[model samples]
Target chain A: EAEVAQSPRYKITEKSQAVAFWCDPISGHATLYWYRQILGQGPELLVQFQDESVVDDSQLPKDRFSAERLKGVDSTLKIQPAELGDSAMYLCASRPPGSGIGTGELFFGEGSRLTVL
Target chain B: SQKIEQNSEALNIQEGKTATLTCNYTNYSPAYLQWYRQDPGRGPVFLLLIRENEKEKRKERLKVTFDTTLKQSLFHITASQPADSATYLCALDKGSGNTPLVFGKGTRLSVIA
Candidate 1:
């Protein structure tokens, strides 16, 4: 079965340092998403990509956060000058396009947990 | 602002009993509602999807009911077992083709044997 893959299951960084998380979505999926999940809260959309172009990033903290899906298959989310408040679980998910007998369904990865102190 | 609410507290149920979880939303209509299960320190796994036009959907020992008028969805697990203990989340699609889903905080269930 195809599954989204994420790396650095756990990451610890110092404040003002840089951290990056990578995700390889399910093969052939056209849509990818990055979400931030704070403890005791639901996952919040941080960025979304359709193919190689960003579809939505309204919730992303542009000042310090950035994400890229260069070849439209794998993606990376980076945080320059990480802050303590950035500690949380970053999740990646993907889905195919269109609907029908195989209406696209979203699949998630184990996620990368980050801690900045 | 749109919001999804699930019980923040844990729910305890005995094995072999039925476990019912509620999800309520405020503001905005969802194209479809989905249920997912997550074990500790792991990601969510999709379980079922119920569309606004559909009243109910079922699979195996799980059942999902959606009430568009009430802006709510209920997930039920029958013949619950200890293995069924986990956090269950409810998510909603924003209606945009490429938009990501909005997730609820999730309710934790503990099935005691």
Candidate 2:
């Protein structure tokens, strides 16, 4: 089974620094999502992309966070000047479906864990 | 505004028994609901999804029931094992096109052998 891929399974950084996490979705998937999971909490959507175009980013804190999928295949999420609250598990997910982006299930990556001190 | 709520408390169950978790919502109607499992320090893995028009959906030992009138969904794992231990989350996507999903805090399950 094809799986979503994420890099740097664990990352430790000091506050005020910059960090980036990468993700490669399943080969044929057209939609990708980035989520942040706080300790003992559910995953929160950070950004979503539909074939190189942003579908939703209302929840992302644009001042310090940015995400991009330049070619619509792989994506990267960046946090500049990280804050203590930035410590969390960052997950990447892909949506695969026969139709265009209305409704479908998502497959998630193992996630990149960030620890900011 | 819509809200999803799952039990924040940890549920302890014995091996070979059934473990049931609850998810409730308010303020909006969803076209479908989904359940996911997450181990500590990991991302959520999709378990099952049930549509509002469907009353129930099952996959092997896992079963899910959606009650749109009640605005709640129930997840059940039968003959669970220690490996089944994890946090279970319930999510819903608002009906609007391209809208993102909303997730509950999740309920932690601990299956003791």
True contacts kept of 2: 0.50
Q: Write the per-residue lDDT of candidate 1 for residues A1-117, one digit (tens) a residue.
A: 888999999999999999999999988888899999887677899999998999899999999999999999999999998999999999999987673222445799999999999
Docking class of 1: medium
lDDT for each residue of candidate 2 in A35-62, tens digit (9 for 90 to 100): 9989888889999998899988998999
Q: Measured by TM-score, how close is model 2 to the native structure? A: 0.95
**Which stretches of model 1 miss by more than 4 angstroms?**
A99-102
Estimate TM-scores for all models.
0.96, 0.95
Which of the CAPRI classes, incorrect, acceptable, medium or high, describes model 2? medium
State the lDDT of candidate 2 residue by residue for B27-62, as single tens digits: 978887889998887788888888888899999999
